[model samples]
Target: MLSPNLLAWSVELFIKEPGSNKTVFWHQDITYWGMGETDDEVTAWIALSDVSVKAGCMRFIPGSHKGGIVDHEDTFSADNLLSRGQEIGGIDESQAVHSPLKPGEMSLHHGRCFHASGANRSDDRRIGLAIRYVTPEVCDQAPGRDWAMPLRGEAPAGGWSCIAGPRGLFHAADLALYDSIIEGQTATLAAGAEQDVSMYGGTKA
Candidate 1:
């Protein structure tokens, strides 16, 4: 449901180790993204392995995005997969819908959707690649600069700079760029967060 010529805000890999107790608490994608409330963003979650209920597949509340952004309490628990451990309270678990995906399958959700995943109890790992896409119209309202990789359209004029694609996997230059991105993005994501944000300081492998 996005427009043509989309740029990716970020592409992150979500990995839930087997028997891990880490959970993704219910929250919206746009809450801490530094982008103000808007429906101009979407995330494509592509499963790299089987994601079943036992493997902690994502569960979404039907039509919850219609209510727009809601308040989230950040628990900052070590067991939470989210950077802030954000959770929206008072959710009716009975209305939740589980999204199970097989290898190579995917699911797309709006930025404002209320979604979360439980702990993995399966024997195998659950992995998914999340691609956050944003329309050119969406701008970062928080502080500092933001980056985007041009995927399928004209380059944006401002608000986001184009990050270069990797020349080779694990290349030194590419790794340096990733470090710079995490350094800059940490400020935006950690803005207004009350607890220690050391989790955002790590460089991607």
Candidate 2:
């Protein structure tokens, strides 16, 4: 089990075309997330295609999560995969570990872990699915309401409201809910109260 207090949050998909120079700068996932208090979050990175160092597989600094959230700056570079192109300064790349994966393999990392990926230098496309799970006890620090899907065990109250599954694709009711949620997210992130909050834009990958 990931954690008794944790619950699944969100998932994101990332695609890198062949010879793409785009890179994910060294950073911590918790830097931009709204999850409050607890850092008990995990991300499952599943590769849709064979990912090697040449294809820009993820790299990590072992035991980095123990250091908690580190400082990050928005590079806003067009070649960065992050929404705001945020990058952590003073990362010792010499201590990094390259993580290569087969098509069906997956790797798990803590939300606070320091990680990043290089530009795709291979001849084939690289795709990855990142599913994030967080503790329900964690509250959204950003202003505005939040929602989450309950996966298992006793659901916790407060922080995130539960939403029902959509009956069909592009269903009217579902679309309305989505639009409302997106609007709320936009407002929350646009407050610009802090560097991390301001840097929160779209999916990092």
Candidate 3:
């Protein structure tokens, strides 16, 4: 059974505009996350708008997580949504399972699951909020500091910096804090990458 007590590692709001060619290539969430092969993390992808197959809903490979982390190629394609366009080659597409969700509905997947989303062909935007949760035991192995916000039960004792809730909507202090977190995390995500990480724009020396 999954634990009810969890900390929010991160929350990302994805908006794929109508008729957008942006494609999320076949990849695993575990890549470049520095968590190793731990199973303590889960991603709750909540659909803010109707996410249909035509709207580029995410697809998963059944039992792919059992293979653990494998080699990934960084293509850095212009239409790819990933930071590095990291992809796992030789995936049998015929075995993929598409996951479509209605507004307010959510789908959960392990961090190691191989997943990808296609281009949005629908007329409406495909919006979703993905919240990554991790148990207290999960710790970052990448460089620099890491953090998680405690959402339920006792907070973690160490290894992660516990972030506080935002003070106000678009507050200056809160915005600054948000920028700091992104800047710090960019380094960890871009570690060992070939081309400079374009996530923050401008090349990193």
TM-score for all predictions?
Answer: 0.92, 0.87, 0.93
Candidate 3 clashing pairs, residues 3+ apart or interchain: none
Comparison by lDDT, 2 against 3, better one: 3
| Model 3: per-residue Cα lDDT over 42-138, one tens digit each | 9999999999999999999999888789889999887788888888999999999999999999999987899999988999989888898998888
Give me the runs in candidate 1 sitting further than 4 Å from their true place.
142-144, 198-205
Task: Report how far off residue 178 is in candidate 2 (Å).
Answer: 2.5
lDDT per residue as tens, model 1, 1-205: 5878788888878888889887888989888888988888899999999999999999999898888689999888778788887889999999999999999999999989999999889999898899889988788874238888878778777788687688997999989888878777777788899986644311111
Cα lDDT, model 3, residue 124: 96
On residues 70-167, what C-alpha lDDT tens digit does candidate 2 reach at each position? 77887777777776677899989999999999998999998888999998899998888888887666778752386666776667677777666677
> On a 0 to 1 TM-score scale, where does candidate 3 land against the true structure?
0.93
